[model samples]
Target: MRGRQLRRAEICLLVTVAAVPVAACGSERETVERPTVPRGMDRQADSDADRLAAEKAALDAYAGYLAASRAASGRSDPHAPELSRFLADPLLTRVQMSILQAKEHGAMRTGTLKSDPTVTSVSLDSKPATVEIQDCLDATGYRLVYAKDRRVVPGSGGGRHLATATATRYPDGRWLISSGAAHQDQPC
Candidate 1:
């Protein structure tokens, strides 16, 4: 019995000693070697990434331009000739229609009001762009007067209505206003 017990103790001690050496043999962190990339492959990857980034930037700029056009004042029918000159293609036509509608009938102010965004300046996508716009008119005076039933008649359109516009890059590489939105409460 004593001999057997001594043998078991020796085996445990040997295992513990072997385990200590094995654990100390390797580092806790693994060292990985980076693979070498071919020059042509690297260049191609970089170029593709750059192109993608440029496209993304152009799209973002287009969207922002449209947002501004919708929020800013729109062209006035009183100066229709001058406004029409700047208003080109389908985009301008839509703005004209919106202005006319505002002149004819009042707009609706729905629940959860969100004011339109005004774009300061739109850098055309290298010029020659296509643009589009969509918008809704509001009659509310921004909580100046409360009550849904309380109809606060809007004053005459001052002169120009702020328009939100979105320009998109056409196939020709020109930036055009693809969309626009405006509230024609007051003339501009």
Candidate 2:
């Protein structure tokens, strides 16, 4: 049960190694604005306090997702505990797979991922409430590196890019990041 956690500590010089993809990591994203109650969301239907609470909870979920992803990638551990706490299927499986691949290749992503995230919209009236967030992830500080030697992998430094995610409130009253995407090619 304890075989797969990758240590971020620098490795001995003699170990063989490879690089992980920088695209697999993101973190330290700050919320830029209070979520707007826009179309698909009824301001009259839900009280301001309720709407604000939902939005805040959703953003909190988004933050958790980023933090969890960052930790998992840094450790190259797909089964990181926080991943399950903040994310659901599809996205959950995707992130785990990314980290697993990095682990298999003897690499991991390490360093801070600076970002500015904003809640674009929220839909509390929808069956299971949801919030959409957009972000400019400045991953310039994040890098993919060989687990051994802690050397930065060539061509693996990151840059600011547009990213998006959907936070869904479940029947259990937990808000989770259900899905997300980073448009690596689209600089923000």
Candidate 3:
């Protein structure tokens, strides 16, 4: 019996030694390192993508707004009383008053003619809406053109009579030029 017990203990020791080598062999193999980028670089990429998306959205909105305005003009008169209703504001009112005063001062004719200006294109930024005017003519001593806004000032004629205009939205969901100046650098 003593001989048999000694043989069993030796067998167990041999099995344990063999299993140790197998486990150690697996651990000895090298693990490939993962590639990594700096935290700041990742943040920059995210910021750039966000900025590009915002710019694209703003440009798309401007394009849609211009398209609708052009369609409205084609379907109706540009100088319609309804159209002018959208231009209600202190600035526009002042412009109308100035034009009346100018006409009275002999700079323009007292008699006004009807004009229907066509818009070719329109671009809007944060502060102004730039417009491309077509089919314009002088009527009632006023230049009927596709301008940023109606009511042009003297000595500011050129480039479709580039007038600076501000747009607003009404409670009835209508868009219109709420206010405008003759130019960007100077006011009409």
Candidate 4:
């Protein structure tokens, strides 16, 4: 019985020793490194990443514009300096004019103006990249308030507006809205 027990212990020790080489071989196979990207492919990947980053920046700028517009509705001055950071040229002028008109009529909006913008397309091949965005405006919670008595304006029910805007990226990597048009009573 003692000899048999000794033999079994010896067999177990041998088995463990034999398993070490098989485990080491498996780890060696796993340690093999993956192939590196080719030089041309690497450059292409960089370009793609840059393009995607620019697109995201443009979208962010558009969102900023929407926020500015919402805030402008509550202010007497529609051409707030903050709005200029996101808008440029003809579009800026148009928005400013509209805000001025509303102010002149003693109209101000209260509550939130929600906007959801979607980037339909982006073209970054040119110096000034162009981006097209579709925005869904929800003014359902917004209320038009009169400046004189702070009374809610009549027929001021909030509605949905669908708008398409075009933005241009400047040399300084800033994106600004160039033009935009909206249709009232449209489904978001």
Comparing candidate 3 with candidate 4, which one achieves the higher TM-score? Answer: 4
Which segments of model 2 are wrong by more than 4 Å? 1-46
Residue 83 of model 2, lDDT score? 98
Q: Which residue pairs come into collision in candidate 2?
A: none
Clash count of each predicted structure: 39, 0, 1, 0
**Strongest candidate by TM-score:** 2
Candidate order by decreasing TM-score: 2, 4, 1, 3
Question: Of the candidates numbered 2 and 4, which has the greater TM-score value?
Answer: 2
lDDT of 1 by residue, 29-105 (tens): 42223345676997788766755654454455544443333332232232254333233457666655654564344
CA lDDT scores, all candidates in order: 0.46, 0.85, 0.44, 0.83
| Local accuracy of candidate 4 as per-residue lDDT tens digits, 30-92 | 445534667799789888897788678778888888778768878867868988999998889
Using Cα atoms with residue i matched to residue i, what is each candidate's TM-score against the true structure? 0.31, 0.74, 0.31, 0.73
Candidate 1 lDDT (Cα, whole model)? Answer: 0.46
Cα lDDT of model 2 by residue, 23-139, tens digit:
233221322234345765665545777878888998899889999999999988899999999999889999999999888988999999987889899898898899999999999
Clashing pairs in 4: none
Off by over 4 Å in 3: 1-35, 77-188
Model 4 error, position 56 (Å) = 1.6
lDDT leader = 2
